[model samples]
Target chain A: MTWSLPLRKFLLYAFIIIFGFVMLYPIIWLLASSLKPESLIFSEPGLWPSEFTLENYVKGWNAVGDVTFGLFFKNSFVISIIAVLGNLLTCSMAAFAFSRLDFPLKKVFFSCMLLTIMLPTHVTLVPQYAIFHNLGWINTILPLTVPKLLATDAFFIFLMVQFFRGIPKELDESAIIDGCGPFQIYSRIILPLAEPALLTTAIFTFIWTWDDFFSQLLYLNTVENFTVPLGLRLFLDSQGESLWGAVFAMSVLSLLPIMILFFLFQRQIVEGIATTGVKG
Target chain B: MRHIRKNTITAYLFLLPWLIGFFGLVLGPMVSSLYLSFTEYDLLTAPEWVGLQNFIEMFQDSNFWQSVRVTLGFVLIGVPGQLFFALFIALLLNKGLKGIGLYRTVYYIPSLLGGSVAIALLWKNIFGFEGIVNDFLAILGIEGRSWVSHPDYALYTLIILAVWQFGASMVIFLAGLKQIPGELYDASAVDGAGKFSQFKSITIPMLTPVILFNLVIELIKALQVFTPAYIVSEGTGGPSGSTLFYTLLLYQKGFSYFEMGYASAMAWILVLVLATLTALIFFSSKYWVHYENGGS
Candidate 1:
């Protein structure tokens, strides 16, 4: 049945708004529940907290003995930052090679890189673990961050390759004519021009690294070495219903950095996924 | 000749980091993992040759079979459920709606946070017996059990969680929808085609490529899902093993049980199955997936 345009628009808006609210309700609920007292969180599931308190945040911050949420946050930031820098540098270099450089066996190497994009990480998990274990790097951030330095994240390389290909070859040709070497041309021309792709790589690397749980769970054994994911998992193992408020508080805290990044770079994140089809 | 040599050297220099990573992290480990699959290595001693033993035992393992069932159920159900919502919302938002960017941003937020431990933990509480879900059900005079804790319903909650983060796929689908020339719709309308007929004739055919891409990517991802099941079941694989994902069981075997060889076998099985499934999908796409430029 055909309806009037204004009536149709109103109904559409109403439906969209209701569905969007349902999509976002869990996150909003978590925020509200974190503010409520421990006893009231499950009982009072309304959006509004009956008794608002920062006690959960306070307690969750100091939940672990001598190893507070501050340390976990610091640890997460350090790993994510290092990973972002590593990916930006290494992946961009590889992308430049694939997109702009003329090299022997380039087709074969490029095809191999593309194949790795679809290869499940589980296939290499055991042997990689053994290699790291043999290196005495079991409890260190080296396992998590070192591979990133070597451009192991093929998706970022593919992304930057696509970005780099868009740049005109004439710019690099002229740079070569001006006596600039390949390295200089890459730094002076390509790196500056490919800022958007690099930033996308950096943002995604940070978020993915921050959110990575399995590798962190496998590598970091001690509480002192734990990142945010491991630290949050500690809450689950150590507490029952009594500390649900604190767990929720820490959960909210863990998502804060990512949420901030999402708000700041929502357009780039969305466009990145659209262009590359990278899945987390 | 000298210039060609110089270019080769320069290119090799640029690819050095990736080359190191390729060998050390990916290819080398892949070869070693394949070898480890047939050996009885447990980190304390050198690998002893035990050809086909791990694979043999895997077939008889009931837990392995359970995990396979759970994981297949998740991928079969979750991926389509997610893509359906993604495509539906994308179609709605592609109608030249005002404030479209705001809606896209609001919808995309969940996907950005979907993979995190925090969301998994939140999911556990939300599906708990005394959780917000039950509270909502009570308001409607419906009694709700602990969904995440129930064997029959545990995996469905995780599937719902997967479907909840359809924002990324939605964004991708929206981009695809925008690329469909509006003239097609206009032409179809001139032929007296209804909206549903227009969508079926033009929209579905044009969107098949994107649908295939999303299906394959989401399928591969859904197969490896671990965090939600791990967090929801507290790493135990559930009250009755209903949430026992393939990767979770593999993790238990390798790390917890120290059966690295067995885990490697499981990994190879996953890789083979994944490769075959991907090949099948691409092969099947010949008759279905459409491209504007036709076959390249």
Candidate 2:
């Protein structure tokens, strides 16, 4: 209280700005280094590149063995889009039922859904692999996209259930009195009203699926089927020191979709985490 | 009666996908995994029931024990370290500063990128021998080694990476901080409480529920951490196996070594351990965690 208020504010801002720079320096360094020529990446620790080149981006796009990074991007987009659609359709449907409808054993089913949110994926990994393997779903996108269609992502279901619970029951009652069916209420009223939650579900599903590595590594064997994460991993394994620029370039490219999504839907993503306690 | 029947049928129709998924993907796989744990199956041959052989061998496996130690060290150290930074930064940002939203976004970018292969790759190079970390240390005249490749420091780098991504938890903490009523702080000040004392008396107790939430979530996440270790160690868990996380070891066993049965056993152990730890935390919550509605 003795110090001038402006002085205190300046000091606080100074500390926060410096700390913020330090936190972001790694990513900034990455962007800068990716622009630099390969020879100078590690040698030049400075964030600014003396000279910039698009060579890394060009070379990295070609990636490994006749498989362009474009293919990986396409593969990633296909899987992510399918996953987003699957989660939105199935999770919202499940949430609508749980939040509005009456059914036998609803409590038991709801409890099971909640428990699955906390259940570790490891317990289901091997057997899930076996199931997919038996169905000849290996080396395909089915393994990634199929389970989503069944609402196996219980986190999104839980998230949507929370959102759906906030919708007034009177809306459903009026629809019912007007002779609208549950399906009509779901598609017409709830789905339209749940846009924010649906968008949150879509964004998170896309980002998670795009970033997912383990299942993709397991099922996606061929280079043609490799998603962005797998393609990036291939860069690590196949490339040498000279390709560090390319690696950094591809890495930045790999994160672009997520970065864009985060920027566009920043409020929803933050609120999604706050309300549901789900990780971004 | 007809309306009730129609509603029940409609609910089941809506739940049809989840039910099929539950029985087909989750419950079925879980039961199959449990059964597989007691057998010796390599995916090529039929599963031959061995009755605890995999579990018995796991106890004597030194690498398994090493992985347990590494994973436990990671969860124990990394979770608290992350939560501490999160809370601290949250408090700093909770001061109603200008451009707080920008600061929050900047801090949160790491958490968004944290789980990706690109970030893990970036972490590996950043800690490499000639990486930027050493370059910065050189400015201070402190010689540094390849932290990721070094046996003694490999796991620490991963822990540091985990801690670096505290932005998500920090955002959660910030939300919790905003929820604390201004009246409480004013009342405590009227009683002549100092800043630190007021924080102790008011802030800590009010934030316990959010703290517990972040703790459990981060604990489970830290236990399952794989991408960073896998990428950093190049899937070898090398440099004398200092970074052999449990999930990494399980991945190697099941896929790389074709020891599906043994891996199934390991998976069960993780499930049991995770369940017990979560239960312990929830049970301990009654003693410390304060709810406004007097405990859920």
Q: Quick one: best DockQ, which candidate?
A: 2
Per-residue lDDT of candidate 1, residues A1-280 (tens digit) = 8899999888888888889999999999889989998888866656899889999999999999888999999989999999999999999999999998889899999999999999999999998998999999999999999999999999999999999999999998999899998899899999999998998898889999999999999999998899999999987777544788998999999999998988888778888888888653
lDDT of 1 by residue, B215-294 (tens): 99998889899999999999999879999999999999999999999999999999999999999999999999998889
> Across residues A2-121, which tens digit of lDDT does each residue of candidate 2 receive?
789899889888998999899999999999999998888877767889999989999889858787999999999999999999999999999999998889999999999998998888
Q: Would you list the C-alpha lDDT of every candidate in the order shown?
A: 0.92, 0.92
Per-prediction share of native contacts kept: 0.81, 0.77
Q: List the residue pairs that clash in candidate 2.
A: none
Model 1 spans > 4 angstroms off: A239-241
Interface DockQ of candidate 1: 0.81
- Give the Cα error of residue B216 in candidate 2, in Å: 0.5
